[model samples]
Target: MGSRQLESFVTERCRSGTLTVTEACHLFDRLLTTRDPAPTIYPFNHLFTTLVRMNNLTNHYPTIFSLFNQLTQTNQISPNVYTYNILINCCMRVDRIGLAFVLLGRALKEGPGSNPGVFNPLLKGLCKDSRIHEAAAIVLDKMPKLGCTPDLFSYNTLMNGICKMGQIGKAEELVDYMVSKGLQPDVVTYTTLIDGLCKKGLLDKATQILQCMISKDLEPNVVTYNALMNVLCKKGEIEKAEELLDFMVSKRVQPDIVTYSILIDGLCKKGLLDKATQILQCMISKDLEPNVVTYNALMNVLCKKGEIEKAEELLDFMVSKGVQPDIVTYSILIDGLCKKGLLDNANQMVQCMISEGLEPDVVTYNALMDVLCKKGEIENAEKLLSFMVSKAVQPDIVSYTILIDGLCKKGLLDKANQMVQYMISKGLEPNVVTFNVLMDMLSKKGEIEKAEELLDFMVSKGVQPDLVTYNILIDGLCKKGLLDTAYQMVQCMISKGLEPDVVTFNALMDMLCKKGEIEKAEELLDFMVSKAVQPDIVSYTILIDGLCKKGLLHKAEQILQCMISKGLEPDVVTFNALMDMLCKKGEIEKAEELLDFMVSKGVQPDIVTYNVLIDGLRKKGLLHKAEQILQCMISKGLEPNVVTYNALGCTAQTKRN
Candidate 1:
């Protein structure tokens, strides 16, 4: 047969999907040995495109690269534009865009016949990788030189890329550029900007763009409505999202699976599970099938509400309806079961996942490990870690962190430190939480120097300590009575752009109050106010208790008035401190008046309240008043504990003497 006949046969076989690996090899041999001397690029380009298409179906993207290399190196046939386009597409799909660009440069050098078809794939690949700047450069600067002008698709691709990167302003500018070039902005262009603005919380601008699109007579598609609905749902504007859904149906734009999924997820998040389920039913009635994501949303909500059995039933229901359960389904159920202390059932879930041929991912293993660690079953958690390694599933930093936290909780600081070193050896740099957990444990054990060493190590490893880390260090230093060191640490944290939170201020204030440094504590309170950090109830309580202990009852009373003026209602602890002070001062009638005030303020007196009053009255030899207070305590349904009995017992002994 002639070369043309052989080429035609190859094309027919490739197009019909009848080309096997064995047959492909035989056809290449015929092309190579053909007596036509110099072959046209037709056969080579045809074969390459065919191979790429077949690989795409099977997800064998790497195979396309290997085949392309073999054809170029072994065969002396020059490739055409079609061949380059197919190879660029294959490279892009396999995340080898760098290699795709190299082929593109080669194509540009060969010159002419390069069009939007050749360039659009590269634009899309770059856009998908979030290389919007590079993609825009190619369209504006490179396209004109290559004799390939930018089209509406080119502008759309770049705008979409920019929007995804949250540069909505740049996307809008690109749209203006497209319009200036006499290219009309379509529904897709408007939708892309809307989605980006919505994600960036610039919903007003997104709405304006939607209005502009409508004015331009560009009818919004399902995708456009879906994007807006998604944003509204996320913003917790369920009512607005529902109105939009109604409007979409009124306009006869059919709601797809995504529309229902978004609405269902929104309602579920708002804790309206019944409403979410009704949306699910409405979707089914409309002949739309619920996918794994739709079911996963419901299952997640059920699990969170502690309705695990209902979630489990939903899982079975989905499976019965031919919807396969994914890793997320099992993970949610496992987490729920673990929280409920159903470790045995959670283990069974793992086994069930494996039995269904779904290999448990790191997330699944982490969930199980975290539960075991919390239960003080570190040994069992270690065994599971080994099992994960045996299955060739690499354990993530989360897995190690869970184990470290477990060891720390069990007071095994040495073992936990060793685990941190092991994590480093495995090249999994400990995150801020990992370091914070270790530092917190070490500091609590009176190993402040060791905790500081860990902090330095974390800095050396390029892990910036977060607010939680600073708070932990501050709390630890305060506990150890290292006030100067703790103060210096707070200064350093503030200088590093970390604002001192309520926890930090409270820790310092508490330490000062306890050390009788009332002056310094008051100054700290002033500083906190200047910094706009409102003093909480604990702050005022600390001051009141400190003043009362100092025997300055008048000052303490004034502070209580100030706390109440600031809208910080004194709690039971605050009242107990004042009552105890009054009883000790032999002012029993004044203490009784304070008790009446507490009751008027709707603060029920606890056992301590009654005990203080009864002890004071008994000490004053007012035995009848003490007896009346005890009877009132009994009437309030408060059963006296050992402390209450001891207080009354001491009073009775004094009376007998």
Candidate 2:
């Protein structure tokens, strides 16, 4: 059979999808034995090109190369432009740009019987595969010497490749070259350059190029405006992007679905929900139906701003508009519900996704698991985790972190630790938040040493500790009566360039007070105030109680006076402590004065306050005064507790004597 018959046979087989490598090789071998003087090049080239296309599709580059060699060397069949195009496409697909260049050189120099047609495929292939420089070299230098001129497709392809490579300078030069050679760049050429500049975040340059294209009488297409709009929106230039949209419509360039979607997403991200809603209305007004992407963008914004009711309303509107919510839509609602601590509602939405035939992606499950874990529903989280594993949804670092944090919060430290180990075994690294959670739990359990070891482990793992981590450790040490160690930790935190915040100062103050180091605690309190760190109620309360416990009643009174002077009004606990101390020292007059001052300040005395006052009067043998205060307390709707009754009974016993 002739080459035409052989090619026809291969084309038919390829289209039928029944062609095998062994069968093709056999057919090509038989065709090689033909002794026809005028061999038909068309059929042989077509057969070879078809085989090359098949090999490229299957990513069998080597097979395509071997076949190319067989056709040229074994069969003595001349290669054509079509043959070179196929081979270069394969090379480009495999990212073998250098090998593609070598083949282009061979095609340029060693044409079919040393002709120019062989180089046509090489140049066309380079252009199609976006090898701009090689195409330019052949078109500008080598092809002209061979008396071959590149067509408009080749020029446009070369321009696109150059622009895409961000060598816009060279691309502009190529455009100039094309115009000099009596060629005008079409919309594709301009769009390519415009898209290229936009991708590089050079919006101004892209706009300049668009103006240049317009000056050249090339009207901007929907794609041109879309690219510009997307770039402008991403840069937070929404007003300019909107102006462009108006300009596009005025210029008779219709906006596509993507154009509206981009603007909606941009406005939603900027928290311009009203503006986003306006754009959605405009999109519908223009008879351009909003897509799922548009609805999802609005939904995500509403969900993030805690507008779940509005988000759900929009979702219903989306469904009514015949736009189905995709994975992103479900994920947004799930995440929102989870954040609001409504796990059951979140799970129902997830089930809705599944009922709609949408398999929950890792993000959907992770959000659900996070909510369950955060709500201390570890059993449900573990069950979901098992379901995820069974469904082949591999657990990422976040999944492990959520579970670990939950376990630690529930005081299941050993299980939490095991999870950390499991995460490492799975080749996932625990992040800073993970360590902080574990450290906080350990500290709360009085395992200050273990918590410190974890902190050290975090450092060893190259995870830098944040302020919360340091505060947890300091508070733990202080609670365990290790004031010096807690103080040293504060120094360490400062050395690490982390300024001690209110929590750090409070921890230190608490430690000193617990250790009876009232003087140091007062000094630290002074420093805290000077640093503009307002002492919280706990800080003032701790210092006051500490001084009173040490029998330094004058100093304790001074601190209380100073606290009030600083506009820090004492709470009920503060008054109770002072009263308890005064009554214990038998200072009835001073104690009564404090009680009167407390009442004058509108600080109603609680049961403890009344009990303290009654006990003080009874101890001083002022039974009449003590009984009168008890009656005043009862009349004021303050019930006498067991302590009050005991104090009153003591006064009654004294009265009977």
Choose the strongest candidate by lDDT. 1
TM for candidate 1 is: 0.63
lDDT of 1 by residue, 241-297 (tens): 999999999988999999999999999899899999999999999999999999999
lDDT of 2 by residue, 283-369 (tens): 889899988999999999999999999999989988997889999999999999999998889989988999999989889989999
- Candidate 1 error regions (>4 Å): 1-115, 125-138, 161-177, 197-222, 228-255, 263-289, 449-462, 481-657
Error of 1 at 412 (Å): 2.9
TM-score of each: 0.63, 0.52
- The positional error of residue 440 in candidate 1, measured at the CA in angstroms, is 1.4
Best by TM-score: 1
Q: How many backbone clashes are present in model 1?
A: 0
